[model samples]
Each structure stands twice: as structure tokens, then as C-alpha cells.
Target: MLYSDIADVFDRLEGTSSRLEMTSIFSDFFKGLDPGSLRKIVYLSQGRLHPDFYNAELGMADKLVLRAISFTAGVSESKMDELWKKEGDPGKIAETLMKNRKQASLFSEPLTLEKVLKNLTMIESAEGRDSQDKKMKLLSNLLMDSNPVEARYLCRIVTGRMRIGAGSMTILDALAEAFGTKEDRPDIERGFNITCDLGFVAETLAIGGVEAVKKMKVTVGNPIKVMLAERLPSISLIMDRMGGRCAMEFKYDGIRVQAHIDRDSVKLYSRRLEDMTSNFPDIAAELRKQCRAERAIIEGECVAIDKDGNMLPFQNVTHRRKKHGMDQAVEDYPVKIFMFDILSVDDEDMTLRPLGERRSKLNETFGLSDMIQLTTMEVVNSPEEGEDFFNRALGKKCEGIMAKSLSQESVYRAGSRGFLWIKYKKDYEEALTDSFDLVVVGAFHGRGKRAGKYGALLMAAFDDESGKYCTVCKLGTGFDDAFLAGMPDMLDEYLSETHPSTVDAEMIPDVWFLPTVILEVVAAEISLSPIHTAAKSIMKDNAGLGLRFPRFTGRVREDKGPEECTTVNEIISMFEMQAQNKA
Candidate 1:
């Protein structure tokens, strides 16, 4: 496949608003690609030389790119910088320079699809450690052979900002379109779940067509990203809608932990599935010391408190989560483990086991040990009985109750939240000025008394499906006059004219921002909205979601990334829990 052909498709996709049109364009585009090359093509479409998580980035920044563009367009560095400052985007800056060039005629040579594909392959093999002189020379050489418009996207691709908007969902939709069946999507997703490799899925799709996707099967112990959920505000909401009686348990206020134990060692995984073995050395050491069985995978919570037994907040425990300084951090904020459920035991992946059996096996295998304790739970038959336990939990400084379905057939759904496990908490029910950690994505230019600085800013929730930011709410409050006055200087470093991989929006502010800064926000309540892009139509038709009467929480959450901000799934869980309480 030619690079120009891919780029042309990208252009059309970016311009179109209709899903049907986008799918049609992609179906045609997928026809020309073979399996191995199709895999490569998907990655290239996102301007990534390789998959992001396991691989190191090419690490090309914008300044070096501007230099390359200047060389290509025959412009001075000073002139290019001015254009960059004005446009706030390298691609835009390049476009302006290209337009100003004396020899830039309407009859300039156009880029062919073959040449674009060839260059993309070449770039994948190019090492970032190559000398700047050599790198610039290579770029300049490529530029001399290409026209200005092609050079514009080429520069953006190398710098990791293609502005093509070819997100993960785009590829998923494209796969479904090319394969010509929505029924095959589950199988295709299973392929990704096992391999955790989109490139591999794309290749299979191209080679076997939809039949390749149909060949995907479930594989146990592949270490997929586990889907997690928040506790609902009330257990009554969970039970009122159920057919019969349900089982209930306690909801602990602690870090969720997934433990995988082999013969020699035990590893801990966070909800994000990032290995935290180094972060919780004490937990690993204790698991090895206490466990009688060799192979097991369990889930639990880790709570930190003082010798006086006062529960610490989530923030304090998070401070001790550094990869290095484990010993010191453990000393500062030692935690107690409360094991709840087991997923596997003795070489058997028991995730499909009923909650009752899993609990029994977990109880039989690992009882309470030092630093490891079982969660306190009661077998309640009614929502009223569960409510009493929920109240007792709050009185004891616990989060709330986790109402579980105790039937022998209840299985642990990895990466799903059905009625099997539900959390009921008072904090979620009582409309607080609920605090949210949101990402800053866009900013409106200040006016009048606030001239030369930002006034209101656009905030977003994390979209895990696409790994991007979707606008949830706009915040301009909770700032004292002094904080507001000094906002521009603090935020200027993060200013951009384009959103990164995880940010998507229909409305562009005066300035786009890299999803870097995380802010603490307080809102009266969350409500459905059509305007907000975060969780758009995720709840009901034509209804997106956002926080109502949201104000700044006066906390920046500077330690976190935009990706670490509260997610759309979390918000939806909270909403569902609230609805249950009303019922």
C-alpha cells in the first residue's frame, strides 16, 4: 500500500462526520492491504511506528521537526518560530511556510501512494539515536523529494502528532466494515484480548478476511486488562431490580489488588494491569510466606492506616506507590491486605467458577495471616439487611458494602461489570460537592479584566476504550482571584493547537492542550447532557454525561497524568448506582 493512499484515506476520514461514509471509505481502503502490511498500515495510520505500551517511543519532539520543516521550506528558524507561536501547531506552521514559498506553484508535484508507503517503512527502521545532523539530513533529503503538503503530514507523523484522528475505535470499526459483519466483532475483540496486539488483529483481518477474525478463541491466563467498576451508593438499588434475594459483602476503602502467584513468586496487578510487584514488595513477600498453594490468582484491597487504626485517605497511600523507595514508602505508610475473591488456584484458571465456590476455595487455601486478612462480610438476604451493614461499615470508617450474587453459578467476568458484584456506598449516594480529577484539554482566551490569560478551561474524562480524552465539563471556578490571575503562566507550557492521541472534541477552544494537567473538581451532582462529549450517548440516546454545578476543587492533582484522571466508565457506574437507589 502506498503512504499517499493511506494519507488520503486519513484526510477523508477526518473530514467526514457520518459513520457510514467513514466505514465505506475504509472498506475500500482495506481491500488493497495484505495481512502483514495491513497490520503495519494500521500502526502507520495512527502515526505510530509500533504499538505504544510495550515499545519505547521514537521520541521526536516538535522543535526538531520545525527545524526540518524550515530546512525544507527555505525559511529562517526565527521566521518559523514566529509562525509556530502564532499557529500553535507545527503542521499549521509548516502549511503557512509552504504557502509562502516563491516556487510553491499550483502545479507542484503530487505525492504518490507508493512513495508514501516506502518512506513510512523507512522511518520505522530509522533509529532515534542517529545524530541530529544525520537525522536532519535524512529529513531534508526526504523533503527535497516530496511536495509541501506531503511534507506537512510527514513531519507530523514523525513527531507523533499525525492530526489524522485515526484512533483505536476507528480501526475497530474499520475491521468490522471490511469483514462485513458485526457478529464477528466479538471474535475479533477476543483476538485482541488474547494477543493484546491490534497490529496482529489487523494482519489477520487482511489475510483471512473476516474468516481470520472468526478463528479467534478464548485463551486463559493471557493477562488481559481487567475491567473494574465503582461501588454504587446503595444496595437497595442493586436488589430492587433483581428477581430474587442477593448476597452482600463489605466495600473497603483501599487500593484494589489482583494477585497472581506462581511457584516461586507472587505478582500484583493494578486495575490498569500495570505490574506493581516493585511498588508492593511487602505484599509479595507476605504472599509467598503465607500461601500454601503454588499457583493462584486472587483479588483484594490494600488499606493503609496508623497504629491507632485510623483509616488513611487514598492520596496518602498513592504517595507511597513509587516504584523505587519501596522500603522507605512501606515504612511511611504500611498497609494491611484484605483478600476478598480468588480467580485461580493450583494451575486451574477459576475465573469462570461461581463466587460461592471461589470463596470457599479461597477460604480453604489462604486464611488470615499477618498483613493478610479476609474481608468482613455477612450473608444478608434483603436490601434492608444490606443497608444496615452498609451503615455499620460507614460507622466503622469503611467505604460501604459490596453486594454480590452468591449463587454457585456466579462467575467472575474478567473486564466486565454485570449484576454479579455491586457496591453500595453513602458517599456516592449523598450528592457531595463530589471531587473529580479531570484533564485540561482546551482553554478559552481571557477577555476584559482577564485579558492576556485564560478564563474558563475545558475539562475531560478518560476514555479507556480509545485511550483519549473526551470533554466532560468546563471549569472556571474554585480559583481565588490570585490563582486566576496567575493561571496563564502556569498553563502556558502545556498549550497546544492540537489534541493528543487520547483527546477528541467537536468544539475547539482558542488553544488546544496536551492532556497533561489533572485538576480536582467538585460538583453538586452528575447529570446527563447532550453537549458534553465525555461518555456521549453512553447512558441513553442523545444523552451524554457531565457533572452539574461543577466547581474547581482547589487541588491540581499534579502527580497524575490525564490518562490517570477519572474515566467515563467510572462516571457511568456512579450514575447507575444512583438510579438503583431511587428505584
Candidate 2:
């Protein structure tokens, strides 16, 4: 296929805002492609060359890209820099320059899809001292033959910002529409949720249909999306939700970890599916040392501990997130991982089994070792018993208790949240004391004491149904002077001048972000608002849920990803519970 055809689709996607229209455009583009080319096209459209877990990136810096643009398009470096400052995007500047090139290259030729993919792979593998020069030349040569519209998309793909509204779900929807009927969407999505590879799933569906997609299994290397739980207002509510008799486990205040173990080595992943194996080398070593099974995939909590074995706050483990001095950090902050659930053991897919059986496998595969142990759990039949368990957990400095159903249907539903598991905490029965994990989507400029820096941030909750970030509250309080000063260094990596396609908000800010950073926030209550888009039209006609008097909790929540933040349904439940308390 010609490169211009693909560019036309993305260009139209950037201009259109409605998700349905985006799906239609992608479905039309995906109709007549071969299987291998379909896979590559999906990855490229998502601004990626590999799956989500890969650590390598294109490594193209804005300054280097500007140099390449000026060298190839015959624009002055001064002019390119000026345009970059005003537009804040490398792709836009390239689009403007490529429209009127001052020089024509001798090697220019018509660009093709294969040519784009091959050149980009070469750019990604470029390394060593001369990598920057190599990247500049490779990209400049590609630009030498690209049309104005094609030049826009090529630059955007290299920079990892396509500005297309199509998310993972959008692509899945289009694949189902193009390959099969709407009934096949759930199976298609299940394959993606299990494998975390949409490109591969699209290829499977296009070639072998839904049955082949359904045959996908939980592999040892590919990380599955972690399961989630719903929160209850009280112990009685939790008991009622669980059919009055359930199993409860201590909810530790630590990092959520999912370890993939083979006979030899082990890998750890955060809740957002990021590779944390290098950061927690000590934990990785422990898992490998204590394994009793040939192969297994388990989930747990990694908590920092004192020399006396007392648990530390989640903030204590944040130091391990640094890129350097990891050996020293491990010595300074020791950790213990409390194992909870098992997803696979010895090549058998344990995800389909009941939680009771999964727990049995977890206990059998790895017992109490230096850094690993089963989570503390018990069976409770009444509210009184559940409350006692909850109190014991809080006394041990834990957050609360996780009440899980003992029913036969209590299977591990990966990448989903529901009432199969419920969280009962100290704040639920109190005056809304539980802090929320929210993502930063937009920010406003500061004044007076906070001049020349960001004063407030527009926060949002992850609406899983829509795969978008919806605004909730503006966080301005509970920030120290040091945090205020370090805002730019923390948030500039996700800076965007155009409104991000993944975020849905009625109110705009001075600056927009790509929803990458997660922060811990607390609020007095939830209220109806016209400005915020969270829970929009779900409860009321036009208003969405918003937080009243929201404040930061002084923690960055580095362990959690933006998609793992609090959800729209959780906020709506909290709002209704608040109303019930008032009555």
C-alpha cells in the first residue's frame, strides 16, 4: 500500500473527535490488508514499534529532529526553533516546512508502507556515540521523498505523539468491525487483555477468525492486566456483597506486583504493566531463589520493611524507582513481597480456576521464604467477624481488608473490575478519609506566592468503559514548597499544546498533559458539576461527578499508572454512599 493512504487515515483521525467516526475510518482502512502488514499497521498507528512492555524507544530528541528538518527541508535552524517554540510539536513544524521545500534531493523517491517501516526500524536500532547523526540522516532521507501530509505523520510517529483519538479499545472495535461482527468484540478484547498485544490479536482475527483468537493463552513473558476490586461503604455492605460469607485478606500498603516466574529466572511488573524487574533486583532474586514450581505467574504486594520487619509506608519504596544507585537503594530500603494470587503454574492456565484453587497453587508453589509469603487471610461469615479482620489489618499498619467471594464463579477475571472482590477500609465508614489515586490531565498557571509555576492541576478518573480520562477536581492544596518548585521537571515529559485525545473535559487549562502521572488525592465529598466530565450523563442529564475541596496527599503514587487510578463507577458509588449517610 502507498504511505499516503495510511497518512490520510491518521490525518483524518486527528481532525475528527468522535470515537465512532474514528472507528469507522480505521475499519475502512483495515478492510483489505494482508495479515503481516495488518499487524505492523496497527502498531504504527498506535505510535509504537513494539508491544507496550518493550523498554527501547526511538530516542529521537526534539533538538536533533529540528536539526534534521532544517538540513533536509532547507529551512534555517533559527526558523525551525521559532516554529517549535510556538507550535510545541515537531510534527506540525515538519508539516509546515515540507509544504514548501527550498531544495530537492537527488535520492528522493515515492514513499511506501514497507519503506516507512524499514526506515523506522533502522532508526530504532541506531545506537552508540554516532546514533544521533545516524538518526538525523535516516529521518532526513525519508523526508526527502515524503509529501506534505505524509511528512506530518512520519514525524509524529517518530516523536511518539500521533494526536489520534484512537485508543486500544478503539482499535479493537475497528478490528472486530473489519474482520467479523460486533459479537466477536468480547473475544477479540479478551485476547488483547490476556496477551497485551493488540497487533497480534488483530492479525489472528483477520487470518483465522474468533476461534483462533479465543485459543490465545496466558504466556509466561507477556504480562496480563491485573484484576481490580470495588470499594464498599462498610463491613456490612461488604458482607452483603459477598453473600454474607467470604474470605478476607489483609490489604497491605505497598506496591502492587505481578511476578512471572520460570524454572530459572523471575520478572516483576507494576499494575500498569511496566517492567519493574531491574528496579527491584532484590525481590527478583528472592522469587527465583524460593520457587518450588517449574513455571508460575503470581501476584502480590511489595512492601518496604525495617530491620525489625515492621512495615513502612508506600512512600518508603518510592526511592527504589530511581534510574541510578539501585544497589544502594536496595541496601537502604529492604522489602518483602506478600504473595496473594496465582495466575499460572506449570503450563496450566490458572486464571480460569476458582480463587480458592488459585490460592492453593500459590501456597504450594512458593511458601514462606526470605522475601515471599502468602497474604494473611481468613473466612468470615458475618459483619462482626469481618470488622474484626479489618481492625486487625489496620492495627498491622495495613490499609484495610479485601473481601473476596468464595463462590464457584469467583474466577480471576483479568483486566476487569467488579463486585467479585470488595475493599472495606477505615475511611469508608468515616468521613470520606480514604485518599484517591487520580491522574494529572491539565494544569493552570500559578500567581502570587506561586508565580512562574503551576498552581493547580486538573485531575481525572479512568472511565474503563470509554478508555478516556474524565476530569474530576482541581488540586491546589496540600503541596509543599519543594513540590511546587519541582512541578516542571516532573510534568514536562507529557506536555502538549493540543488537547490530548485520550482525555475528556469540559473545562480547559493553561497547559495540557497526556495523563501519565498519578497522584494521591483526598476530598471532602463528591458533587454534581457541569465543568467536570467524570460520570457524565450516567447519573444526571448533563452534569458529571466532581470533587469538592480536593487536596493532594503529598504522595506521587509512582507505583501506579494513570489507567490504574480510581474509576468513574467508584466515584459514583462514593457519591451515592455519601447521600445515604446524609439521610
Candidate 3:
């Protein structure tokens, strides 16, 4: 297929903010693509050359892209830089400048999707001396062959800023529409959840049909999407939700790691699917030594330890990820792994098994050692017992307790957040029971001491019923100078000219953003307000719930997506609970 065809679809998708329309456009575009090229098309649409787990990025900086655009458009670097400053986006600058170029290439060839994808792969794989120049030449060749419209998207993809407002969920929706019925979506989602690769799933569905996708299973070395937990306020509510009996495990405030062990070979992945095998080589050696199974996939928490063998906070363990002096850091801050759950063993899928069965297998598969042990847990039948366990976890310097369902149907639902598990943290006893994970929807300009930085962020809660983000709070406190200074670069890709279709807001700020980044926030209380849009008309006519004195917790929920953030219904439930307590 011609690359221009894909570019036209990108233009249409970017012009509209509606996710449904974007999905429809993507579905139609997918239908026209060759089955063999579907995988490349999906990756390119995501501004990637491979699945996220592969992590082979284009590695093109803004200056590099600008240089390539200038080389192709017959413009100076200074002139392009000025245009970039005014346009605020390199993609747009390329589009505007390329259309009015003073010089034209003597020879041009029609660009194909295959050539574009292959050339981009070469750019990514380029290495060693003068590699930057090689990458610039390759990108310049593509720009010379591309028209102004195609150049716009090409630059965006190279610069890692394909702002089409479509994420993995939207692409899955499109894939279901293009290759199978809507009823087959769950199977498709399951395939993605287990394999953690949308491109592979798309190719399988396109070439081998839905049955191929349904046949996908957990494999060693491939990272499965980690399961997530929802938050509730009190032990009574947690016990009530879990049928009065549940397993309570200590929630460690450390890195969540999934270890894939196949005999002597072992690998580790973070909760966000990042490869961490090299960072935690000590843990990998420990797993290889202690794991009894020939092949297994187990999840655990890796906590840093002090010289006296006491657990340290998460900040201390984060230093282990640094590239330099890793050996020294590992020795300086030794770590231990507390195993929690097992997903697979010897080519058998355990994700469908109940939590009780999985826990049994986890206990049977590993031998205890000083470097590795099972998480501290207890079976509780009442709220009082659960609260006592929570206090015990706190006494051990842990974050809190995880209340997990022990029902027969409580299987691991990968890439999902539901009531199967609930997290009760230390802050629950404060004004609010749990801190909310909200999405950043807008930002207010700073003044006075905060000049040149964002003063406050407009936050929102996800409404799953309507698939919209509703404004709930304005978060301005708790962010230190470092965080404030990094806000622009962190949120640059999500910056938008207007509110996204997925967002519903009452008060506009100096800037809007797509609902992408998730932040943990705490508030003095939940109150009804006429200005906020969250839970509107449910509690009272035309009044929505808002956060009072909302402040950032200095924690970015990187493991979560915007759709998985705290929900409006959860907020309403908390509000009602608070009112009952007052009564």
C-alpha cells in the first residue's frame, strides 16, 4: 500500500477528537491493508517499530528530526528552529515548510508502507560512529519522497509524538471491527492481555482467524499484562465485598517484578512491562537457584534492604535501575523478593486457576531462602481480623494490606482492575479513605514564585459508563520544584489545543491535555459543587462531587492507564459512606 494512504487516514483521525470516529477510521484503514503488513501498520500507528516489550525505539531527537526536515526542505537549521518555536510542534513545522519549499527534488519515488517501515527499522538499528549522520540521511531520503501531508506524520512518528488520541484500547476496538464481530472482542482482549503484544494479536487475527487468537497462552519470556487492584476505604467494606472471608497479604512499597524462569534462564519485567532483568541480576540468580520448576512465571515485590536487613522505602530501590555502577549499587543496597502469585508452570497456564490454587502452586514451586520468601499473609474471616493484619503490616514498615478475594471464581484477570483485590493503605484513616488516581486534563499557568512552570493541574475521574473523564479537582500542592520543572516535557506529547472528547470539564485552564497521564492524589474530603462535572445529578440536581484541598501525593501511577484510574462511581460511593458516618 502507498504510505500516503496511511497518512490520509492519520490526518482524518487527528482532525477529530471522538474515539468512536477514530476507531471507525482505523477499522476502515485496516481492512484495506494487506494481511502481511497489518503488524507493521499497527506498530507504525503507535509510533513504534516493535512491541513495547522489545523497546527498540527510533531514538531520534528533536534536533535530529529538525535537521532532516531542513535538509529535505532546503531550509537552514536556524530558520527551521524559529518555525518550530512558533508552531510548537516539529510535525506541523515540517508540513508548513515543505509545502512552500524553494527547491524540489529532481527525482522522486512513491513511498510504500513496506519501504517506510523497513527504512525506519534501519534508522533504529543504526549504531556506532557517524550513526547520527546515517540516521539523518535515511530520514531525509524518506522526507524527499513524501509529500507535505505524509511528511507531517513521518516527522511525528520519528519524533515519538503521534498525537492521534488513540491508545491500545482504541486499536483493539478497531481490530475487532475489522477482522471479527464485536462479540469476539473479549477473546481479542484476552489474547492481548496474555501476550502483551497488539501487533502479534492483529497479525494472528488477520491471517489465522479468531480461533488462533483464542488459542494464545502464556509463554515463558513474554511478559503478561499485570493485573491491577481497586481501592476501598475500610476493612468492613472490604470484608463485606469479599463474602466475609478473604486472604490478606502485606502490600510492600517496592518495585513490582514478574520473574520468568525456564531452567537456568531467568528474566524480570516491571509492572509496566519494561524489561528489568539486567537491573536485578541478583534476583534473577536467586530465582534460578531456588525455583524447583523447569519453567515458571511468578510475580513478586523486590524491596531494597539496609545493612541490618531492614526493608527500605521505594526511593532506595529505584537507584538499582541506574546503568552505571549497578554492581556497586546492588551490593550497597541489597534486596529481597517476596513472592505473591504464580501465573504459569511447565507450559501450563495458571491464570484461569483460582487464587487459592495459584497460591498453593506458588508455595510448592519455590524453596525459601534469605533472598527470596513468600509475602506475609493470613486468612481472615472478619473485618477485625483484617484490620489487625493491616496493623501488623504497618508495624513491619510496609505500605498496607492487600485484601484479596478467595472465591473459586477469583481468577487473575490480566490488564484489569476490579474487586477481586482491594488495596487499603495508611492514608485511608485520614479525611478520605484512599487516595484517588486521577488523570491530568488541563494545567493553569504559573505566576510569582512559580513563574515558567505549571501552578496547578486540572484533574478528572474516569466515568466508565460513558467513557469520559469528568473534572473533580485542581491539584497544586505537594509537588516539589523538580516535579514542577519537569511537567512541560512530561506532558508535552499529551498537550492539546482544546479539551479532548473523552474529557468533560466546567472550568477551562490555560492549557488542555489528552487524558493520558495518571497521578495519585489525596484530598481533605469529597464535597458537592456546581462547578465540577464528576458524578453530576446523581447526588443532587446539577451538583457534582469535587475534591476539597486536593494535593498531589508526589507519586505518578505509571503502572496504570487513564481508563483504569479511580472511577466516578467509586467517588460517589465514598461520598455516601462519609455522609453515613456523619449521620
Q: Number of backbone collisions per candidate, in order?
A: 8, 0, 1
Report lDDT (CA) for all predictions: 0.69, 0.87, 0.88
Clashing pairs in 3: 428-433
TM-score of 2: 0.97
Better of 1 and 2 by TM-score: 2
> Candidate 1's residue-wise lDDT over 1-583, tens digit each?
4455666677787665455566678777887776767777677676775654333344456787777788878888888878887876676676667667677545435555555556555654566567555556556556655554556667777776666545555567778778657787666765665344678788877777677766654332334445334454556656764434666666677778778777888778665445677778888888767777887777788888787766776666675578677788988888878888877778665666787788888888885665888888777767777778778888867867777777765776655556677665566667541367898888887788778778888989987765568887878778788888777766765666655544767667888777767888878767888778777876778777877878996766754445568888877766765566456
Q: Assess candidate 1 and give its TM-score to the true structure.
A: 0.75
TM-score of each: 0.75, 0.97, 0.93
- Candidate 3 scores a C-alpha RMSD against the true structure in Å of 2.4
Q: Residue-wise lDDT of candidate 3 within 1-583, one digit each (tens)? A: 8999988888887788687898899998888777778898888887888887885789888888889988888888789878877776778888887789765577888898888988899999999999999999999999898888899999889887787767788889999999999999999999999988899999999988899999999999888988878777689988999999999999998889999999779989987777888889999999989989999999999999888878999888888777789889888889999999999999999999999999999999999999999999899999889989999999999999998999998999998878999988877655577778899999999989898889999999988656679999988999999999999988877776656666889989899887879999988889998999999999999999999999898888775667778899889877876675555
For model 2, the local distance difference test gives 0.87
Question: Residue 293 lDDT in model 3?
Answer: 92
Q: What ranking emerges by lDDT with the best candidate at the front?
A: 3, 2, 1
Which candidate should be chosen as best, given TM-score against the real structure? 2
Q: Please write out the lDDT profile of model 2 over residues 283-369, one tens digit for every residue.
A: 888887787888888999999999999999988877878799999999999999999899988889998998899888888788587
